[model samples]
Target: MTQPSQSNNNRMVIKLVAIVIGMFGFGFALVPLYDVFCDITGINGKTNPYAATYDVNTDVDTSREITVEFITRNQSGMVWDFEARTKRITVHPGELNTVEFYVKNPTAKDIVGQAIPSVSPGTAALYLNKTECFCFEQQPLQAGEEALMPMQFYVDPQLPEDIKVFTLSYTLYDVTGTSSVAMNRG
Candidate 1:
């Protein structure tokens, strides 16, 4: 009887160990799986960070108008004032539009900042094409300096008719320390 009980305990322990290892492996695989899923379904609002080319001959969908809303924020501990100059705009798909963002370094020291953008209703991300965007590069501003950054973009005419409104939000992060350290080392 004693031997049988010991064997049962060992088997249970082995099964539990295997379960944990399997769970750990699955955790490691989640990121890649999520990326693939997003790529297929376009549900995570991930936009191409690189510039996109626009054809001049593309037909403009003048019959339909879409509303785009812009929002901006500073990351925690970042001491810069950042905002979109225009809060909202109505535009026809396939027509080029430009928007300006204002940024100011109120601190006494120079700082480098980067802006990350995301679009709501994730499905609209693939349809939003940016030809030029300040978010593509890091911005360096001197103390008490202010600057206007521009973004040129258009909505693909193929965007789904259901997605008539979308929000574009940007969060600015202060990369001063990392940038300065890299510059000094190089």
Candidate 2:
């Protein structure tokens, strides 16, 4: 037979094991739970927010036709189409890459609005060489048409040095659409 002190010790051990199991369960359930929270709040930058802090620039590199794409907001009633010379490009820091941005209307009818470009995860503007494009300004494109856009950029030779590659992504959004503060084209 076990002494009372031994029985008490055994009970404590069992309780500790149960607590550990509960902690693991909580840990396993947290990832998906956090995702849902981010989805709703856009704290993850997956959707647009009520007030976004970014820059807007509209300029074309008359010589280079760099590619740009329009990624619409979630189930919101909007769409995007992009036209550029290239989608995948590589260049050394401080080297200029002429990027052309073209905004093509997706709707059959003319839609007048602005295009907000954002760098996903959490970063400020599109940086190239000596230029910082913080999402540029509001653009007004005609319906069922295309507009030429440009971003003259060069990699920052001092981009952490250890960083060899980075994809300059453009995520197009409409002011009058769902928020995709987290979902970026990164």
Backbone clash count, each prediction separately = 0, 27
Model 2 C-alpha lDDT per residue in residues 120-166, reported as the tens digit of each score: 33221223332433245455445567767666655433444334433
Model 2 residue 155 lDDT score = 41
How high is the CA lDDT of each candidate model? Answer: 0.92, 0.50
**Per-residue accuracy of model 1 over 1-186 as CA lDDT, tens digit each:** 699999999999999999999999999999999999998999988778999999999999999999999999999999999999999999999999999999999999888998999999999999999999998888888888889999999999999999999999999999987774332211
Candidate 2 local Cα displacement, residue 45, angstroms:
9.7
Highest TM-score scorer: 1
Give candidate 2 misplaced runs (Cα > 4 Å). 1-75, 118-134, 176-186
What is the RMSD, in Å, between candidate 2 and the native fold over all Cα? 11.0
Cα misplacement distance, residue 90 of candidate 1 (Å): 1.0
